[model samples]
Target: MATTTASVMGPHQKYAFEDTTSLLKDINRLPLFMTELDPTDGEGGSNLALEALQALAYEGTPFEIASNFKQQGNDCFSLKHFKDAAEYYGRAIAAILQNDKKKEETSGENSTDKAELAETDEHGSPLQIIDNCGPNADDDEAEKLKELVTTCYLNRAACNLELKNHRRVINDCAEVLKVQPRNAKAYYRSARACLAIDKIKEAQECVERGLDLEPQNSYFKNLAIKIMQREDYLLKVQQQNTQREFMRKHVVRI
Candidate 1:
């Protein structure tokens, strides 16, 4: 003879439970099971609970939430908080991926319904469409997500460079280039990372590619100069070491 009631997240509304084992169990599973919810209104109280949970995560759509995270990353980057910026960018990327996955699932379900409906259509079937579906479906949102993710990768690369994580910088820059082949900043960051590891030829190639994309980029030009200087310094050191070895081997005979 116990009663339990769920409450909305905001305000002083609290639920009282005497033996609410089922409700407590569901609340515990909210984080893991929320993503599995139908998102539509048919799934009883679970759907409503999922919506409230999502609203608590962010105040808008997935794209908007991802954009907000990206902006936060940029703000941290501007203040030179490289580690914090990387974390924010990571969250933004996760949000975008999660959004895309949900959209794909919804699209698949709609496509199945439409295919079934088309079988019984007298007038070529009334097209059943999801909110975002088809070839150009959410294309604008797709492009925005791509741009945001690319920017985040490039920004994270910059942070890695500042942190002297040269290998990670190279990897992040490579990721950006995968998304945006002609990104000058990606090439620039990759080139800088290559130089840090004494990858002269790779650095040169990166700089050349970057300069090919942006012929008048002062940053690329300066980096190219620095690479040339480092190469010269390395060559001089190598020659000195070779001479020292030769003298040590022959002078020992004398």
Candidate 2:
């Protein structure tokens, strides 16, 4: 008895299939298909590129998009559009926050996977020989994100200062300082906001902190001078008022 393979095609049989390249060409002909995209033309193209970037922002990894938003915020700030700049910086901060959450989730998943691998094969595990005790990809990403977040906060603080939103300036500067304790711009911006709202002592403290961070910063030096002058003027005014009150109360028979 002769046995034959059951899954074989006969000699006269041929598989019916369309050409993949032709199919691809046909698909590309569709109006909605964007086979070719140019991102450097005419204010960065029309809605197509904009919509694509927006989709990427929603779907892609957060760092690049967040950085892009930061650059946009800087551009608006250069043009002195404080409110618009603040909005852009706010978007960058939101993206970074989302990115941090995603990283935490991924780290948790990786840790669980590592644990399960260890349990399943204690000797054969690759991690046994080469332990990665040093900084990892996630750690680098986290540091980069921290820098970006600090920059965004500082820029937002500048915008808030320009808008006369003193409380918001203080808040943003404080946020920056949380990530970058020696940031002179954060201290200076916070101090400026404090001075704006008549928190003289707080403003002085911020100035001193900034000066300690960057003693040669001309802006901080100028601000320190301004604060001192303002304080002197305030003291002079107080003394004049006190003298006027004394004369009024101790008036003799004149």
Candidate 3:
């Protein structure tokens, strides 16, 4: 029996000779898909293609979306667009928080009472049970997201500082400190904002904490000096007021 091979079509044979030029023309029109096409024009496609592309660019996992927004915030900050940068950082924070809520809900659903009754030793004392369950995959992911959220808060604080939103800067830095108590930048920023608003005590506390974390940091050192100077000035003003009050109260009648 004789076997015959199947004839495969080559590139040139795939289309009719005259139709090849028309196909090339269609290929050349591909760029037009991205542009907003006029509805009255002969083109059948709408701007949906462009919209879809834009949506696709934004679609990602929560961490990825947060990271993208963070990068956008960094770009805006570099350009000194502090207000826009803060907005982007806020978006990043919202994205991460949304993911955290979802994770919490899922964990609630899958959680069980894994705790057991404690066992007693030979002497009737409760035995010390050390949990060897080290950090799991979920723990690792949570830690990463926490770090990202802290970074977003810190960046937003920086933007707020440039915008002179002292309270907002303090709040953002407080959020960072809550998550990362040893964060020197958060303490520094918070101290700066408190000092800006004349919250001398608060500023002094933040400066002390930051200095404890970074004793050699020039920024913290300088801020500490400023806080001390402000405190002394306020103390002098209070004393002067007190003296004036005493003199007014003891003034002889004319």
Candidate 4:
């Protein structure tokens, strides 16, 4: 399937049409269904396109509005709005990834966290952390923030998946679980990473934990079944390989 790769430049440039033609070209690297998407004056999409969408989003565009609300809701996780912080973090990472966010990282992993930040938490210090989603809030804004923690992690995990950083994805899922232990998506991601690294037993364990946390989650249930099947298949393969090797080595010199 075609994927949305990050621009060599930043999201600001990307959103500002600094290289519209190239962006469009990259967008069209493979076949797409943008047939229904129209550009103003038939000029094709540009920074104007993004701004227009942002404007519509602000002006009651249901989907955009929902996203905005969700973002706002993401702000309620902590009394300090850790979810909002995570969204900002996601945006920052995306920006640096696209080159729009340019804060220096604590250690420059992706220039995510600035070299100097005074942010401290329950852990007694600040760390370059990201999350998938957060808990629920009674207020609208807080609810939005609470809902984003799990999703934010899933979104970031996707980026890691694209980069083939399966191990990092596993760690990201771990962070997701810290916020909400019942996060099925996080477990799915961790299992996927385990499978990628040939840790079938580990993947099975993660899936099982996920299912136990949410017995009704179809995703987790399906994943658990799939992991068991894979584990069995892997075992069969190893056994077959062993038998073949033994046969070859021990066959009488006939």
Task: List the RMSD of every prediction in angstroms.
Answer: 13.2, 17.8, 15.1, 15.0
lDDT of 2 by residue, 1-254 (tens): 99987796543322135466655544444435635433333344445544555545445556676687789799889988888778777776665444332245334332123223322233332212221222444666656766776787788888989999999888777766765788888899998999888788999999999888888999989988888888888889999999999999999856
Give, for candidate 2, the lowest lDDT window spanning 10 residues. 125-134
Off by over 4 Å in 2: 1-56, 100-137, 244-254
Write the residue-wise lDDT of candidate 4 on 1-254 in tens digits.
99998868647644476477656645543223232233333345354544355344334322233355345434433334443444443542232122112323233242223211212233211112222122332355434443443465565565566556787688667766776787777888888889777798889888888778787878877777777787888899999999999999999985
What are the per-model numbers of colliding residue pairs?
0, 0, 0, 19
**Pairs with backbone N, CA or C atoms under 3 Å apart (clashes), candidate 1:** none
- In order, candidate lDDTs are 0.68, 0.68, 0.67, 0.53
Q: Ten consecutive residues with minimal summed lDDT in candidate 1? A: 124-133
**Model 3: CA > 4 A from native:** 1-58, 100-137
Q: Better model by TM-score, 2 or 3?
A: 3
Candidate 1 lDDT over 124-151, as tens digits, reads 2111121222345576755665676677
| Count: clashes, candidate 1 | 0
TM-score of 2: 0.61
Among residues 3 or more apart in sequence or in different chains, the pairs in candidate 2 whose N, CA or C atoms overlap within 3 Å are: none
Leading candidate by TM-score: 3
